[model samples]
Structure formats: C-alpha cells, structure tokens
Target: MNTPLRRLATITLVMFVALMGSATWVQFFQAESLNTDGRNVRTLYREHGNARGPIVAGGEAIATSVPVDDPFGYQRTYSQGDLYSAVTGFYSIANSRSQLELAENDQLTGRSDQLFFTRIRDLLTGKRPEGAAVETTILPAAQQAARNGLGAQHGAVVALEPATGRILALVSTPGFDPNVLAVHSTSEAAAQYRALDQADGNPLRPNTHQERYAPGSTFKLVTAAAALESGDYQADTPVPSPDQLTLPQTSATIGNFGGGSCGGEQVSLADALRTSCNTAFASLGMTLGEDVLREQSERFGFLDPDLAVPMPVVESVFPSDLDQAVLAQSAIGQRDVQASPLQMAMVASAIANGGRLMTPYLVETVRAADLTIVSQTDPEPYSDAVSSATASALTQMMVGVVDSGTGKAARIAGVQVAGKTGTAQTVEGQPPHAWFTAFAPADAPRVAVAVIVENGGNLGNEATGGAVAAPIARAVIEAVLAS
Candidate 1:
C-alpha cells in the first residue's frame, strides 16, 4: 500500500474513535441529567412513554393511565378525583405536579434504584418498563370523615398511629379534584386549577405539613412538657396569676387568653394547662428558661423538614432572647411561634407514645400490582423527645382539658379522649382560628390528631379551638377508633 494511503487510513480510524467517545458521553452520561432538567420538554413525553403504574387503595385502582389523541396524548386518570387529590397529586404534562406525585415521582415512575428487582422482572416477562403500584396507609372511612367533618370552613386534619407512624388520614378543606389537572390539553381544566390556586383563600396548601399557623393553645402540650421536665415544677407546681406577665428584659407585659387573670393567686400546672391559661404558661416559660425550651422544641422535630413525610413544617420559633416576656408569650403559643398540623400531630404522638417521636410516614408499603412487597417503610422511632414520666404527666393534664376544661365539647362517652384546645389570635377584624391536638385512650393512645379551622367558623370572634376544632377532631377519632 502507498505511504499516503496508509497515513490516511490511520487518521480516519482516530477520528472515528473520537466521534464514538462524544456520542457515548451524550447518550450514556448526559442523558439522565438532560432528561431530569426542569426545563426539559421531553421529560413528560418520556414519562408518558413508560408504562405508568396504578395508584391502589383497598385493592382497587383509584388512579391509572389512559390514552388520548394529543401529541403526548396519554394521561393519568383518577377514579376518586378530589377524594385523593391531595394524596395522589396530579401528574399533568402541562402542569408538572403536586402531593405524592411531585415528591415520590422517581419511586412511582420506576426510575429509582430501588425498583431494580421489578425492572429485571419486567424485562424477563416481556412487559413494558413500568413502575409498581403504590399502596397508602389511608382507610377510606377515615378520609371521608376528614372531608365531612371540616365542611365549608377551610382546615386540615392529620391522624397517625401512636405506636407506629403510619398516617391514616390527611385531609385539607376546599381540595381540588386531581382528575381535572390530569387532563393537560384541556385549557378549561387548566384554568380551573389556576382559579382554585388564586381563590380568595388559598386552596393549594392542603395543610398536612405545607401550611403554617399559630398553634394557639394547642402548643400548651409543649410548654406543659417543658415545665414538667424542668424539675422546677411538678404537675401541681404553683404558677401565679399576676394578670399580666412583665418582661424581665423590657417593660412589657403579656396578658392571658382573653385578658382575664387566673382566679386563684397561684394555680397548679395541671390546672393551668387544662384551662389553657396564657398567664400561667407565660410564668412557666419564664421559670423553665430559654435553653430548655429550645432543646425540647428541637427534640420534637423542629427545623427538620422531614419530621414526618417530605412535607414542609414551620419549626418552633424560639425567641433568641430569653426575655422573660418573650418566653412567657411563646409559652402561650403567641408572638412569632407557629406550627403545621403535621407537626402538632407529632407532638400528640410523642405524648401518646410515652415521649418517643416516631417519624411520620404517609406510605405503608410500596407493592407491585400482584401484591408483592417491593419496598416497605419500617416504623422508625425518630427521636426520644421526652421521658415516659413526662408523657404520663401530659396525658393526665390533657384528659382534664377534655373532661372539665376548654375541650369539653370533645368529650366522648365511655372513651378517654385526652385533648387540648386553643383559640388563636387573628387580625384585628378577624376571628381567631380554632386549634386542637389530641390522642385518645389516655392509658394506651392509638391515634394522635391535629385539627385547625380558619376564621373561627365565621362566628365573629366567638370561636374557641374547643368549640370549632375539637369536635372535628372528635369525629375523626371516633371514625378511626371504630375502624
């Protein structure tokens, strides 16, 4: 062969090798990054191309996929629509996601490493690449109870097992049907979501853990726990009713819930918590000091976004200054302190479980359609927030609240439903939102619940958490207990 021809052949081979390297980089290494990019138009197309999985509850497909005629015509169809919107969330090509769909996409879509076993099986079975169906911890009865109990007012209900962190029902009022958002091509339907999102009141929160509110008197549980753990106060510790808590650092005073002082010069901590007395709580907070308060809050899963599920939680905002007044107001659940329904549920659960905070879990297990358990969430004890002794002390005080205090409306016949009530402050002209957190069967708590109602049922500032929120919690607890 001529020298020129040999040299030409060598150069051609080198160029070919470089081209193959570039192609491999783009296809193998860069494909996943490009596909998952937020702006990738082809992402939804690929999601549609895969054999999407079913959303099952009670062995029925509450949600599935069906084919249509648009460019990316296939879509997810929900049988129950609004009934499961907050849980299933909508998977729309036009609008990306919500609920479990947005958070658990990789798992449900079979793109996770955890899906390897199922992926291998599909390959051998000649089945198209598909994800395993998801099973929830929800009971249909519990879910219905949440929706029915809330009625026209906006609120949220979250119930979970005290022994186990399995979430039974999580419902937010004024929920949108997921079916509407699943149909991407229909402009009318998309417009409806926008309207709902921009509604006079926000319908998007689906409260669970996504929204924040002053826990009101419901936060007394934490203060009560802190007070008991401090050793400075026992259940019967004498907390004075000065009518106003004077700030130790600054000349400011914190008043009681309705500006009334505790009738007796000093009341027991048990009596104070049962009455949800603002003055007593402020005094207790001052006595406990700031570090103890902050430690207890952190132990209760404050600042941890994954306190339960992957939902958002407003951490307990501890005052930076240990100002006697700030501590007092915070103890009463006011002046910049906030929490979500989910967070309060954890508090109730910790109290119910003898001071152990179990990480809240929404999914019971991830199983294939054939009932094979592909993955399951082990009931994990997230943190030891307090001691069993503290739990007992708090439980007794909570029971008193339901039996003889502000939470009288939540009383159940023959069943011990320990609870706390909070009538929180709202804007000047607005009635406060009612708040309640509880766990039933004082001796052996099975369910922990947190409920909140917006604008005090439109009752013109007459609303108390016991009157508006506790009843809803009672009904939900009854439903779960019955199950």
Candidate 2:
C-alpha cells in the first residue's frame, strides 16, 4: 500500500474505535442515570408499559398496577390510599414517584440485579416481563388502628417488632390519596399534585420518618439509658429533683410539669422518669455533659444520616457543641433536640429487645413474576445500645410510668406496658406537642411504638402526652397484640 493510503486507513480505524467507545459508554455506563431521568420519555413509557408489581401487606395488596388503555399501559392504584400513604407513595406520570414506589423501583420494575435472571428467562421464553412484588412488614390491623387513633391530628405513628426490626405500621396523618396522582391524564395529575402541595400539613411529606419534631420527655428514655450505661445510676438511684432548677451559666430555670416538687426534693431516677420530671433530667443532663448524651443518642440511631427502611428516612438530629444550660435543656428533649417517630420507636424497640438496636426494615421479601422469592431481608443489629442489665432496669422504670405516672392512659387490661410521656414546649404562643412511646406485654414485647400529636391535637395548650398520644400508642399496641 502507498504511504498516503496507509495513513487514510489508520484514520478510519481510529474513528471506528471512538464510535465503539461512545456506544459502550451510552449503553452501559450512562444507562442507569439516563433511564432514571424524569425527562426521558422513552424510559417512562418502558416502565409504565409493563405490569408493575404490587406492594403487599398482611396478604392484601396496598398498591397495585392495573391495565389502562393509554400510552402507558398500566395505572398505579392504591388500596386504602390515605391509610397507607406513608408507606406506598404515589407513582405518577406527571410528578414521578415517591416513598416505596421510588425506593423499591428497581425491584418493582424488574430492573434490580436480583431480577436479572428472571428478566432473561422471560425474554427468552417470549413472555411479557412483569415486576417483582414487594411484601412489606406492615400489620394491617395495627396500621388501621394507628390511622383511626390519630383522627384529624397533625402527627405520626410508627410501630416496630422488637425482635425483627420489622416495621409493623407507619402512619402519618393529613395524608393525601395517591390515586389522584396516579391518574392517566397528565394534566389532571398535575392539578391534583398542585392542590395537595398547597394543602395543610403538606400531606405529601410523610411525618412518620420524613420529618422531625421536638421529642419532649419521650427522649428521657435516651438520657436514662445514658445514665444507666455510665454505671453511675440505677432505677432506684437517688437524684436531685427540685421543683425548679437554676440552669448553670444562664438565667433560665427548668421546672417540673406542675411547678411542684418531683415527689419531694430528691427522688429516685425511676420516680423522676415516671413523673417526667423536667428539673431532674435537666440536672442529669448537665451532669452527664454533651458528649455522653450525644454518644447515647447515636447508639440508638441518631446523628448518622443514611437510614432507610427501603424508603429514605430523614436523619433525626441530636445537636452538637452545646453549652451547660443548653445541654440541660436538651437532656429533657428540648433546645434543638429533634426526632422522627420512627427514631423514637427504635429507642423503645432497643430497650424491649434487651438493648440490641436492630436496623429497621420495611420490605420483608421480593418475589418474581412467577412468585419465586428473589430476596428476603434478614434482621440485622445496628448497635448494642445498652447492656441487658441496663435495659432491664429501664424497662421496669418505664412500666412504672404507665402503672402510676403520666403514661397511665397507655395501660392495657391484663398486660404490662412500659412507656414514657412527653409534652414538648414549642414557641411561646403555640401549644406544646404531645408524645408517647411504649412497648406492650413488657416482659415479652411484640410491639414498640411511638406516637406524636402536633400542637396538642384538639386539647390546645391543655393537652399532655398521656392524654393525646398515649391513647394512640395504646390503640396501636392493642391492635398488634390482637392480630
């Protein structure tokens, strides 16, 4: 070949190599991002073209895809839409997806690597591809009871199985029906989305795990656990419990609920916890200091952000770099201390499970179109939050709260219930938020639950955690036990 002919051949070969590299990058490396992009019309069509999987709980479908005569062949429909809105968020053509619909999209759309073999088999057999079903850990009875108990309240309830870390029920009130967003008409879905976005409480945001609130006295559980873990206190350990405590380095003072003594000047740690004594915990908080308290909080799954029960959970925050006065206030779950209901439920679950803090999970299993199990979530330990001895002591103390103290409303007939109550003070004008956390049949706890009623529910400033939140937690516990 002539020199010029050889040079032309080399240039052609280089161009051919570049073309192959670009094709590989687009088809392999950029594939996932491209397919997931909301602007990709072809990807949207492909996802909605097939039969998407159902989200099942208690043998009933909470979310399913039904055949529709449209460009997108299926329409996502939710059963008891509002009741389970926190769990099965809407899959919309115009607005895209949220919650479980987005978290488990890979499995539901048959795009998960776990379903790769299934997809190949279907393709080879000339079968129409279908998504994998997600079986949730939700208990229908508990879910219903939670929704009913939180009637007209702006709040959230979360229940967990102590042993398995399975989320039994997660309910967030002021919920929106997902069906409106799942409509075939894009314009209608967009209109519905706009209305829901503007609605009170922002129904689209799930309160159960997505938003955080002042934990109030419910956080006393963590403070108590820190105290016990330090080997410095026991249930009967006597601590200062004055009617009012002058905070160090600040003019503000912390006082008991009724501006009265916490069962006399000095009380047992158990008594202080039972009475939800603000002064006692504030004193203890100052004594333990910020580092110890923050460490204890982290042990129960606070601070660390990457938590997901399949769906992403906004991290519950325990503030850092606190002064003595702020630390005292934080010890009683105020002064920037915030937590989601799910986080508090984990706190109770850890105590009930003998201090083993399990990593909470929602999806129990995933099954292929042929009903073959593709994956099953195993219970995993997130941390050893406290020693078994400490847990035992805390359990007894919590039981006293329900038996004779502020958490009396959570009592169940013939059942030993362990619980704590909280009335977190908000801004000066707004009513305090009510909160309760409990695990029933304390000796052999099956359910650990947290309930929060924002702005005191219907009772206004007069509402207490025992009055508004404890009853809701009790209802959820009873439903779970009965089921």
Candidate 3:
C-alpha cells in the first residue's frame, strides 16, 4: 500500500478505538448517574408511566399512586397531605425528589436489585411493572399528636424509639401540601413548588431533619455529658453558681436566664442542670475545655459528616478551634453551635438508651408488589456517648427538672418524665427560639423527643421552652404512651 494510504488507515483505526472506549465508559461507569438525573425527562416519564408503590405508615397509605387516564397512567396522592409532607416528601416531575421519595426511588420504581425477580416476572408475563411498598416506623397517633401540638407554630418536632432508633413522629410546621407537587401537569407542579420554594419560611424544606437551629440551653445536656465522661464530675459535684460569670479575655458576662441566681454561690451540678443555669454550665464548659466538649458531642453524633435515617440528616455542629469565651458560650449551645430537631432527639435517645446511641432510621420494611418482604432495617448501635452510671445520674437530674424546674410544663400525671428546656436568643431584636427535649417513664424510657418553636411561639421575646415547647412535648409523649 502507498505510504499516504497506510497513514490514513492507521488514523481511522485509532478514531474507531477511541469511539468504542467512550461508549463503554458512558454505558457502564456513568450509567447510574445519568439514569438518576432529575433533569432526565425520559427517565421521569418512564417512572411516571409505571405504577409506583405506596408508602405506608401505621397501616395507612400516606403516599400512593392512583390510576389515571392521562399519558402518565398514574397520579401520586398524599392522604394527609401537609401533615405527613415532612416525612413522605412529595414526588414531582418539576423538581427533583426528596425525603422517602428520593431515598427509596429505586425500590419504588421497581429497579432495585432486591426487586430483580419481580421485574423478571413482569417482563415474562407481559404485565406492567409495579414498585414495592415502603412501610415506615411512624406511629399514626404520635404523628397526629405532634402536628396538633405544634399547631400554628413555626418549628419542628421529632420523636424516636430509643432502643430501636425507629422514628415515631417527625413534624415541621408551616408545612406545604405534597399533593400540589404531585399534580399531573408538569407546568402546574413546577409552579406550585416554585411558589413554596420562594415563600418566607421555606415551607417546602422539612425543618425536622434539614434545617439547623441554635440548641440553646438544651445543649447543656452535651456539656454535662462531657463533664461526667471526663471522670472529674458527678451529678452532685459543686460548681460555681454566681449570678454572673466573667468570660475570659472579654468584658462579657454570662448570667443565668432572666438574671436569677441558680441558688447559692456554689451549686450542685444536679441543681444547676435542673435550673438550666447559664453561669454554672458556662463555667463547667470552660473548665472542661473545647476538646472534651467536642469529643462528647461527637460521640452523641454531632459533627458527623454523613447521617441518614434512610433519608439524609444534616449534621449537628459543634464549632472547632474556639477561644475560652466562645467555648463557654458554645457550651450552652450558642456561639455558632447549631442542631436539627432530629439530632437533639438522638441526644435524648442516647441518654434514655443507657448511653448507647442507636442509628436513627425511618423505613422499617420494603415489600414487593406481592406483599413479600424484600428488605428490613435491623437495630444498629451508632455510638456510646457515656457510661451506664453517667446515664443514670443524668436521668435523675433530668427528672428533677420536670418535677420542679423549668421543665415542669412537661410533667405527666402518671408517668415520670425527665427533660430540659431552652430559650435561645437569636439576633438582637428578634425573639429567641424555644426548645425542649425529654424521655418518658424516666427509669424505663420508651420514647425520646425534641421540640423547637421558632421566634418564641408567638409569645414575642417572653416565649420560653417551658412555656412554649415543653407542653407540646408532653402531649406527644402522652399520645405515644397511650398507643
């Protein structure tokens, strides 16, 4: 062959090999990402045409796809639309998926590896494919109670079964209706989501698991845990209880809430905790230093980069590399310390579960269209935040809070309740956030919960965790116990 012809043939071969390699990479390595892309209209249409499964909670179908006469073939519907919107999250063709809808999409779309047999059977029988049913661990009564308790407040609530890490009830106020996003019209659905997205409170976002807030005095639990774990302090250990504590290197003075003294010049750790004394905890936090506090906080699941209750949980933060004054403030859950209601619920759960933090979970079981269980979530221990002895001491201290302290509003008639209340100041002119966390039947806990009422629950600056959030928590605990 001529030299020019030989060179042309070699170049052509190289081009052919490059084309094949590119095709293989796209077909294999990038296949999953491409298929799951929210903007992929083809995939969206395919999922919409098929019969997606129902998401069942407490024997009720919270989310279901019903038969339709339109090109989509099915329309998604949420029975308790706004009530369960935080957990059941809307499925929309306009925006991407979220919550359970996004987390278990593969199973719901009949494309999960566990559903391989179901897919094969459908293919062989020439029957249209159907997705699996996702059964959640939510308790219907508890969920409803949480919703009713929050009422018109702008905040979030989360309840958990300590032993199993099963989420009992998750709620976020100023909630949006998922049905609006599930409308068959793509243009309409997009418009609805956009309206919610641009709204003032960001109602489309679930504050229970997604948004973070200053934990306030409720985070005193973490400081107490750290002190106890350091082997240097006990519940009755005497700590400073001055009306005001002078922060190091600064003229700033940290005083007890409302400037009330936490008793004598020196107070027992137990009394300080019960009183939610800002000065006492602030002194303790500075003494323990930033390292120990952060360590204990992490043990209770703070600063975790990735956490999922099957759905993603935004990390609770404990700021690192702080000076003495900032650390003192952070000790009381301030100065850049932030947490989600779910994270606070985990903290309470750890204490209730004998210091063993169980990994939080939502979906309990995934069943095929034939009602055969495909997968199940087993109880898993996430971490050990403290010793059994420390937990016992802390429980007693918390019980004291409910009996006579700021947490009195959380007390139940027949049940022994242990809890903490927090009123965290936000900006200079804005109202503080109210917080409450508790576990019931003190000695034998069945439920642990966290409640947050933003902007003082309509009490203006006077709103407090005891006056605003604790009573709501009590109602939820009562509902769970009754059920």
Candidate 4:
C-alpha cells in the first residue's frame, strides 16, 4: 500500500476510536447523574407519571400523590400543607423537591436499590412497581402545638425525643403552603413558588434548621455545661454575680436583663444560671477562654457546617478567633455567636439524655407498598457533650430556673420542667429576640424543645424569653408529655 493511503487509514482508525470512547462515557459514567437531574424533562415526566408513595406521620399521610388526568398522571398533595411543609417539603415540577421529598426521592418513586427484589418481581409478573411509604418521626399533636405556639410570629420550634434523637416536631412560622407549589401546571407552580420565595419573612425557607440567630440565654446551657465539664467548677461553686461588669479590654458594660443584680456580689454557679445572669456567664466565658468555649460548643454540634437531619441544617457557629471582650459578649449569647433552633434543641437534648448527644433524625421507617419494612433508621449518638454528672448538675440548675427564676413561665402542672430563657438584643433599634429551651419531667426527661420568637412577638422590645418564649416551650412540652 502507498505510504499516504496507509497514513489516511491510521487517521480514520484514531477518529473512530475517539468517537466510540465518547459514546461509552455518556452511556455509562454520566447516565445516572443526568437521568436523576430534576431539570431533565424525561426524568420529571417519568417520576410524575408514576404513583408516588405517601409520607406518613403519626399513622396519617401528610403527603400523598393523587391521580391527575394530565400527562403527569399524578399530583402531590400535602394534607396539612403549611404545618408539615418544612418536613415533607414540596415536590414540584418547576421548583423541584426539598426535605424528605428530595432526600427520599428514590424510595418515594420506587427506584431505591432496596426495592430491587420488588422491582424484579413486578417485572416478572408484568405488574407496575409501587413506591415505598416513608414514615416520619413527627408526632402530629406535638407538631400542632409547635405551630400554635409560634402562631403569627416569625420564628421556629424544634422538638426531639432525646433517647432516640427522633425529631418529634419542627415548625417554622410564616410558613408557605406546599400544596401551592405541588400543582400539576408547571407555570402555576413556578408562579406560586416565586411568590413565596419573594414573600416577606422568607416563608419558603425552613427556619428551624436552615436559619441561625443569636441564641440569647438558651446558650447558657452550653456555658454551664462547659463550666461543669471543666472539673474545676461545680454547680454550687461561687462565681461573680455583680449586676454589671465591663467586658475586658473593651468599654462595653454587660448587665443583667432588667438591670438588677443576679443574686448578690457573689453567687453559686447554679444561682447565676437560674437567673440567666449575663455578667456571670460573661465572666466565666472570658475565664474559660475562647478555645475551651469553642470546644464545648462544637461538642454540642456547633461549627459543624454540614450537619443535617437528613436535610441540610445551617451551621450554628461560635466565633473562632476571639479576644476577651468578644468572648465575654459571646458567652452571653451575643457578639458573633449564632445558632439554629435545631442546634439549640440538640443542646437541651444532650443535657436531657445524660450528656450523650444523639444524632438528630427525621425518617423513622421506610415500608414497601405491601407494608413490608424495607429500611429503618437506627438511633446513633453524635457525641458526649458532657459527662453524666455534669448533665445532672446542669439539669438541676435548669430546674431551678423553671421553679423560681426567669423561666417560670415554662412551668407545667404536676411536672418538673428544666428550662432557660433568653432575650437577645439585635442590631440597634430592633426588638430583641425571645428564646426558650427546655426538657420535661426533670428527673426523667421525655422531650427537649427549643422555641425562638423573632422580633419579640407582640410585646416588642419589652419581651423577655420567660414572658414570650417560655410559654410556647411549655405548650410543646405538655403536648409531648400528654401524648
């Protein structure tokens, strides 16, 4: 053969090999990701055409897929739309999915690997595969109580069963109705989503875990835990309780919430905690130094940027590089310290569960269409935030808060409640945020709850955590106890 002809043949051979390799990459490696992308019209049509499973809570379907005559074949519906929107989230063609709808999309759409045997059986029998039902850990009554507790306010409530880390209730007020976003018409759904996304107070976002704010006095729980865990201080250890003290190196003067002495010039750590004394904690925090404080905070799940309850939880952060003044302010739950209601609930849960911090979880079980259990969530401990002895001491101090201190509004009849109240001042001129975190039956805690009322509810700047946020925490605690 001529040299030029042989060269031409070699060039053609190389071109053919390259074409085959490209085709193989698209057919194998990129297949799953491209197929699963929500923006893929074919994938959307396929998922919407099938009968998706219902998401159950308290033995009732909170989210279901109903038949539709359109090409989509089904439309998702949330029975208690706004109440469970933060949990079930919305399954929409336009805006896609979130929360459980996003996390369990495979199982809900009957595509999970766990359903392989079922799919095989269906294929052999020439029958259609059915989606699996996701049973959530939510308690309807507790959820309702949380909703009513934060009624008309812009805030969030998170309740967890300490022993199991099962999220019982998660409520974010100024909630949007998920049904609006689940409509069959793509245009209508997109428009509704845009409206909610643009609404005041950000109704579309889940504030309970997705947003963070200064925890106010609710964070005293962490500081107290740190003090007790240090082995250098006991609950009754005498600490400074002056009414006012200037933060070190800065002219900023920190005082008690109402400008009164905590107890006296010097009081026990327990007494300072009961009173939610800013000066006491600030002084302690400064002494403990930023490294110790940050370690304690991170142990309770702060600074964990990717923490999630099966859904993304915004990082609850404690300021990193801090001087004495900044540490003092952060100790009082001010300065750069910010936390989500979910993180606060975890703090309370860690104390309630004997210092073993359980990993927060939402879904309890996943069952096939035939009611056969396919997957279940096992309870896991996230960390040992404090020793059992420290937890006990902190619990006693919190009990005193409910019994005779600022958290009195959280008291329940015939039940011992351990709680802390916080009134966090925001930027100049804005109302302080109200906060309350608690666990019930002090000796045998069954529930740990955190409630935050932004802009101080109806009382404006005069609202204190005990006056505004504690009552809400009480209601939720009672609901869980009663159930």
Task: Identify the candidate with maximal TM-score.
Answer: 3
Global CA lDDT computed for model 1: 0.80
**Clashes found in each candidate (C-alpha, N, C closer than 3 A):** 0, 0, 0, 0
lDDT of 2 at 342: 97
**For candidate 3, lDDT tens digit of each residue in 1-483?**
699998999999999999999999999999999999989888988899999999999988999999999888898889988999889898987876788999999999999999999899999999999999999999989999999988988999999999999999999998988999888788998899889999878988899999999999999999999988889999999999899999999999999888889998999999999999999999999999999999998999999869998888888999998999999999999889999999999999999999999999999999999899999999999999889989998999999999999999999998999999999989889999999999998989999999999989878799999999999999999999999
Best by lDDT: 2
Write down the lDDT that model 4 would get: 0.92
Q: What TM-score does structure 2 among the candidates reach?
A: 0.95
Candidates' TM-scores?
A: 0.90, 0.95, 0.98, 0.97
Tens digits of lDDT, candidate 2, 173-203: 8998999999978899999999999999999
Global lDDT of each model? 0.80, 0.94, 0.93, 0.92
**Mind giving the per-residue lDDT tens digits that candidate 4 earns over 1-483?**
699999999999999999999999988999999888888878878898888999999999999998888888889999989999889889998888988999899999999999999889888998866799999999999999999988898999999999989999999988978999988788999999889888989987898999999998888888888888889999899998788998777787998877998879899999999988899999999888888889999999999988878899999999988888888889989989999999999999999999999999999999998899999999999999999999999999999999999999999989999999999989999999999999988999999999999989888888999999999999999999999
lDDT of model 3 at position 322:
95
Error of 1 at 426 (Å): 2.8
Task: Return the number of clashes found in candidate 1.
Answer: 0
After superposing candidate 4 on the true structure, give the runs of residues whose Cα lies further than 4 Å from its correct spot. Answer: 1-11
Q: How well does candidate 1 match the true structure, expressed as C-alpha RMSD?
A: 3.8
Q: Given candidate 4, what's the lDDT at residue 259?
A: 91
